[model samples]
Target: MLRIKKLDIFVLKSFLLLFAGTFFICLFIFMMQFLWRYVDELVGKGLEINVLAQFFFYSGLTLIPLSLPLAILLAALMTFGNFGERYELLSMKAAGIPLLRIIRPVVLFCVFLGGMSFFFQNIIGPRAQKQLWTLLVSMKQKSPEVDIPEGVFYSDIDGYNIYVKHKDRKTGLLKDILIYNFSDGFENAHIIWAAEGKLELTADKQHLFLHLYNGEQFENLKSQSVISRNVPYRRETFKEKHTLIQFSSEFNMVDGSFLDRRSDIKNMHEISVAIDSLTTHADSVGRSMYSDIMSTTYRGAVLTPADSVKIKTENIAVINTDSIYNSMTSQEKLKVLTTTENRVKSLSTDWDMKSFLTKDTDNSIRSHRSDWHKKITLSLACIIFFFIGAPLGAIIRKGGLGMPVVISVLIFVIYYIIDSGATRVAKSGEMNIVLGTWMSTIVLAPLGAFFTYKSNKDSVVFNLDVYAAFFRKLLGIRQSRHMFKKEVIIHTPEYAKDIEILDEISKDCQTYLETHRLKGMPNYIQIFTNNKHDDAIAEISKKMEALIEELSNTKDAVLLNLMNNYPFLSVKAHKSLFDNRWLNLLFGIIVPAGLLLYLNIWRYRLRLEKDLRVIIKTNQSIIEQIEKQQLYLQK
Candidate 1:
């Protein structure tokens, strides 16, 4: 027990070290994203140090859940990778330590972290998001700090474009200023130019005042009321001039109370409550609007009691809209129709707007529910990542940050893409919110478990050799060499006995080839029904193998080489007997089975014919050598 604990502690220490590094790295990445998204709000706002610090603080907190899972994934990957790369995993496994036992400590730690993440998401994270979003929104309304550059038209101001050829920043003096004011509309405008000017902000910082010296103003005095164009223009030269532009420089925060708390900023519990409230409200609104439309259009007909529906009463005066219109003067008829049309248009517009509102409410409800599920789902991701990373690392057996980082990033990207798609689906209400929010976890959890299972069983899931072979076969670019261990033969062949056997096998093969026509159409039924004929091939194959063995025994290099040149009998026999199932299925489907079987038989016959030719040539050569040896022996 003590030894096991020590081992687990050692493994955990390494994992934690990597976790610390990776967690901060993940957080930094998310922080950079936050910066990019809100950089415009932060750049020239002149925010205080405390405010900026607070933003970073909340941003980091809000990003914790996101970063935790990735950190765990990377840490587990790195730790196990180190183990496998160094062959420490091999030693442990040899010592009977299972993969699960090796990763137990890290798994427990991840679970603990997952719980902490949940706590933060449910309790602390909401507050941080609320504050962060509030601050960001506040900065949006705050005016951009004054940064007017020279040689460019500054159109940050509404309805105005002001340009300065040169400005002395130290002295805060502008030279050769041009300002265009289109506040009254582009058709009528005022153009102002100054030899020298100074820009200043009002005491309240609500307005920008441009004080100009030796300037001129041009105003086009063409009233929109006048039909004629280019009627009048006014240009005035002045010793000094002042124009005020509306600009708010103060930093005013929006009321946080008015901000919706039911957004993603809410905690799971709060979100659930919000969902319930929204659902009830949406139902009530839809019911009320539909009821109003029906009641107004049909005058309570649809709301009739069951008893009234059943009653067959005498003929009643029905409303004849055509006759009512005919009874009226054209003016009165026009008025009545105008009123009815307006009423119908109003009802239809109201109905459409309400329907849209109801759908929007439903979508919001789904979003909130998804957010609630996400709190748990993201927390669960930490655990899932640990299982995945640890086993994957073990399988890959790569140490350091290089391969592990690449793998972790790829996995996380896949996960995030799936999560994003699921969230969109949930938001659109095409899928159940619970399933949608948990979809990534659902997909990933089993994969992690499978990796664990493979690791525990010592399965070669990441054996590059296996993958390489598969791809090689797929591309038809590689062949595998099956090595056979050479045997140490104690005795040389009895040439007299081996020669007789080889002669007999050769004669049989030659006769079978010469007498049969390989080009004939095959009886496909015989393929299945004629196991009898198949055994004959097997028998011939066995006899061929015996001859090759005898030739190897002769201890003659030339004869051994000849035997080596011959195809393996087992390979030739089975080649026609069975093929890749995919090819068989393809042939069976695309062509009639009889034709396919016949074609296969024809192919096999041709193959047999070739093999027989090789055998016959080999036998002839051996027979000549035996005759020469016998004559020498007689001499």
Candidate 2:
């Protein structure tokens, strides 16, 4: 039994759900298209429904290795996205968990999955596929006796024309059966005629037994009179009646020849040899040459003049400069150069350098020329996706089905496109196989790690300052200009005028309240006055609270408030007071926050839709939001 830790389980469940969902979604879409195109032909050819179903089922099995990595990648992204959105990653990191530690289980799981995929690709998958196709072909070519219609000739089955007057469903009997045998030439063909026949299914259902009574077998022997044998037979049995189909035997095992033809083996051999030489005492010149060859081979297929010539010339120059004849005259140096050139030329010619280079290149090219490599490449993609998804999830922090899905899809699409293009180039011998296969992972891994690192550190990648700057740029708007002087200028008369208006309202309200306190005033007047004051206070409080909330939420409360209050200030004033430059610089910090929010929403929706779909399909009661959360947590 496999024991999964709590955290591992969490990661696995998340990854599995994501992987299964993505795989099935794609599989369903593609399978539907495939089935739609072939279903009619299959049915028209009188194929058994069971066999057709098995064919599709096996087809999905064949596709598993191809889809597994994609599933892993998508699942990793979704799982990590959800974690980031939920702040689980942040919480873990805050608890002193390393990013590598957090991802350890996921990486291990992917390796395990990759191994399983290899087993399927090399073992079970091919066999199942071969069997399915064999059955399908057999079914298509098989003849039906009872199902044959009257008058209309049915020739879907190869080399046979079958016609029957009527069929009895219960007895599985046909009234009149006519089978035109075309196995031999039509000129010398025979006809099978039966007055009444019954078809019985064999135990395995692979063969059918036809029992005929009172039938005549007519034979047309070329250059002889037509021979008709009338028999009053009680029962005549036909053996091996079911269609005999043949399937390719090669699909049973991995082709040894295919593996031997791969260039990767050669590369591996060279690498192994280099490692061995490096470990033990070896000639420095030979070692250097091998090392250079390995590097060139690893980088790509072709090596131009720029690759080896520069290093060779530099080495020769250094050797000559350090020679014992260095103190000799310029003429002596010329003699040494001539001698060195001749030696090098002789060495090159004797070693057949061109052929060696060509051989190495060919070996490198052959290494990746198998379909098996595709499976391996896809399997390894799991790691790439995990890195990308985990960090992205943390940054986005909004893990529902909306933006997270969109972002995940976009990222995966980019990775897939690059990977696929690289694979093609590699197959064409334009690039090295290992480099091409791992290219997408190399490019995206760092990006994922960076995001995860920042997220773990509680750093935002995008902020409101960026939004403000963006808006300003888009609207072609500059900071407001305060045209007034800095010094406060107050006029006594204007201040007095404002004070007079305030005093008048205050006095009137006080006098009215005092008068009402003594007299039994109208109920309507008292109610109206109380309502107006309450409403005014409530409105003021609401406005203040809203502003306070907005400011609290902002990255820079003081600067944001200032910008809101003073719209006519110069750009310089805004920059000075609010440190707008820093704000602009910190704008990227909010990107992670926004992305987190977006992913959270996206994942939530996807989860909800998935749950709802499941419920609908199972005819279960609608699940509440809290219940759904519990279910997700439990899984």
Candidate 3:
């Protein structure tokens, strides 16, 4: 039997409360998004309160798999973050408790959550999905309530358009009603205008009755020849008239099996069975298509006469089309050509439809198989997210919803993006369904293990200074010196004079740019072929660094500010050469490389121009600051 310690109970109590709140928060967020999609179907249909409640309930249940993983991730991040922020983790470490030992309870609970997620997916989720969609389809089928306002044309009903000039909602009456009925056909349209009318639903809500008083009706007589310039029509006047329209207002749920047979409406077992059945059916259709192609299209078209099998036409008469066409008179030939064109068109259309059906069926099978793999992958994601979130929170050591929420949401968004992309690829048969479905886990599990290891060892995995240094090295950039070294000044003179050092460097750079033709395409081509620009740029960079170093000994604040701006000039010809060499080698010498290299060179040129501007401005500021310092000393 297992034993429970006080520490275990304490951790569990705190984590479970946060987990429960976070789970519902995730559910509410997803439900809001769900409502956005189906609001059109639910609203204006006047569905019963219980019916709406059932719809939302089923929708929430169906979203369990999606919400569970995100919830676990956020809950774990918050739980550990709170512990780290409160110094509980630090206290535990000082007490000789391992990080994993502290996290053992949360891990066990997450494992149980993962199992619950799996059960929800396999059993409750599918039924909820079926009921949700069934309700949705039923809502769409029910007639929209007749709330036609005044002075507007409403075309909600099929094959009918109605206009009401004035509506009296209190009296349930419409004045000056105009109705256009094209149910028979557009050419045989019937138009009715009424002085006053009332629209009401039948007791069973299966039909609409329009009772009109002082109405006139006119109907076109389509029996007249279409070539006649004038259409024959009939008109009638009535003191009272009525019409019955077929409209179903009741919400009748579709046969449960209709959408239940869809890929989304099944567990892994059912989906696997569907996959097999669809596969077999698809195979049979393909084989039959291949047989028809071999027997019909290639009947007499083979290169080898002996190998070409003559397709039999039992109980069918065959005619020599070419000779018969040649023997036909001109009029007869026209008739034959027209008939043949129609026949060919019909055959082409039939084959096109068949090809479309075959492709659709193939995609359906892939979708089913992909959904089957998703059942397991989604459950696995909950455990993966817990592993990642808990260790990362421990390593970061900051608490509450601030940093933890951002990190958790960022990680989950990345996971969702990868999972969505993989699902699309799998559904399109670009990759195997299982591999695509598990791609996120395969990519992130190692990362989770690494975080776990680092957290257990108390490593600063989220340390920004370390990462900053590494990034600088990777990009071949030199890091800036934040602290200035104390230097002994051998001479203290001339604070009033203008600085010639920055001016000289700026002059040299401007002169070099003016002399060198690094602007246009011709100059770009010339530079790469034993380019002297590279050597010149490299020399200028060295001089700039040397100038900044000598001036670093100065105690002038403006001079120090100017020195801070000099390191940006380090991003020059050398870094671009080596940094982009990998690009050229991978993309090759011509085509993509040529265009890309050209663009990169132009970008460097723009940066060089910006550097010259900075140099000139810094020299001017140093000159002004020195003048100010000299005036202050004199005062």
Candidate 4:
């Protein structure tokens, strides 16, 4: 038992739901077309309902192998797309899960589907197709009701018009039947009229028989213009049956041995027989060539002796001396040589004829061998189609009607084109069958593998990044920058100016307090003072008024502007300024006290020195002293 993870189970469930929907949608659409095909046949040939139903059923079964792969591809793509969109894929990757591991279940599912397809193709598919074809044949045989729409001219079994006044559904009978038999040659035609008719199914369910009563038959004979025959009482019947309809041989044949006989077996037997014939012919040609060569050689030897005898007889005639002592003349000797040469030439011609016959036999044997190889190659296409479909679906990753249909059609088209071309070449004796039929599979398998690899990598080859990169290269756009070196700078002269003004005001107030404290109270101070320091109080009040007037009169518009701008700059500048260790320590302790006390007296001294440098056009040593003092405090 396989223990599936919760996530894997969820993924599988989602995929299956999608897959089932796609499969059924595809199946229904295909089945509709299948039904339409038979419907046309039924209408044209007047077929039966039972046969039509069986035709659709078997047609549905035959199409399952084609639809399964499409469903699988669609389901997988949707499943993976959902995972990717939800960031589940990212999560899984972060958790150290490999993509291959995630898709293992999908691959396993596809394998199971492939197995089912194989079962259907090898066993169920063929049987279903055979049954469907049988049913169609039977329907043709059983000439059922010709469903003619009212008021429309519908053709009868014999390709003639049939008109019905009315039809009784309960009785399955028509009140009137008028048939024009155009089946006969156009010049000689016949018209059939029946008062009433009923459609009947044959006892064996192999044919539909039409029974008519009270009818007249009219015919136009070529020699005799027109003829009409009428009867007081008449009975006519029409029968239509499919000739190819037959029971399986096993049912008819009593012998169990004959049950195995089939067309496929006969085809195989024919091929084997052809091969054997070719072999026998080759062997016969070889033996014939050997015998012919031997005969020619022996004939050549006999011809030489015959020519010599003739030559000797001629030479004796040419000689005029006594028979015992006479010698052949030069002309007689030359004539003897010429006769021998002609005999040798005749033997060589016979040998050449034998050689030509042997070459022709060898060529015939090679041709037959090529044909045998081609037949065997074509027979193995079923398995090749399986490989092509399964892997291709896995790679495409789209299993629904839309993508699957387009892809299946395109892939099959290519496969068919290649296979057809190869077959043509092979048949024409241009190439061998092994190369032709298997070539398509060999080419497409790698393409499927490439797609599968891309799919597994979660790579969308047509994505924005890919397109951008392509165009970027085409336009030659290339530049690089160091992002880390760029820093945001903040300037804060406003805060320092505000601190200088605050220091001046604090110093003047401290000087007034010290001067008042040094003076003793006058004698009448008790009378005016709420406590007994009346004189001191009056003097302090006068001095405080003077100080307030001076402070108010002092134009600190620049300091006010500085104060207003400091808040805005402080937030921005704090991080950058405090990033330095010394600045962080100094400001962290002093800034809070300085803000509370308004104690910018030391800061004002530094500011006065800066103002002196600007106004007097002279370097100020006080600014240096302030910086040195602040530095010493830090040390």
* RMSD over all Cα atoms, model 4: 28.3
Q: Which digits, one per residue and each the tens of the lDDT, describe model 2 over residues 340-418?
A: 6886676567458755755555444333343435555566666666666666666666666677668767876788788
Error of 1 at 252 (Å): 2.4
Model 3 C-alpha lDDT per residue in residues 140-206, reported as the tens digit of each score: 8877887887888998777889999998979999999999999999988999999999999999888
Best by lDDT: 1
Clashes of 2: 41
Candidate 1 residue lDDT tens string, 335-387: 87787788778778877887799888988888888888899999999999999
TM-score of 1: 0.75
lDDT of 4: 0.51
| Candidate 3 wrong stretches, greater than 4 Å | 221-231, 301-354, 482-635
Candidate 1: residue 34 Cα off by (Å): 2.6
- TM-score, cand. 2 vs. native: 0.41
Compute the lDDT of residue 2 as modeled in candidate 3. Answer: 66
Best candidate per TM-score, number?
1
- What lDDT does each candidate get? 0.80, 0.55, 0.79, 0.51
Any residue pairs clashing in model 1, and if so which? none
Candidate 4 least-lDDT 10 residues? 566-575
Give the lDDT of residue 251 in candidate 4: 12
Q: Candidate 2, which segments miss by more than 4 Å at Cα?
A: 1-158, 192-196, 200-219, 224-376, 399-439, 446-450, 453-635
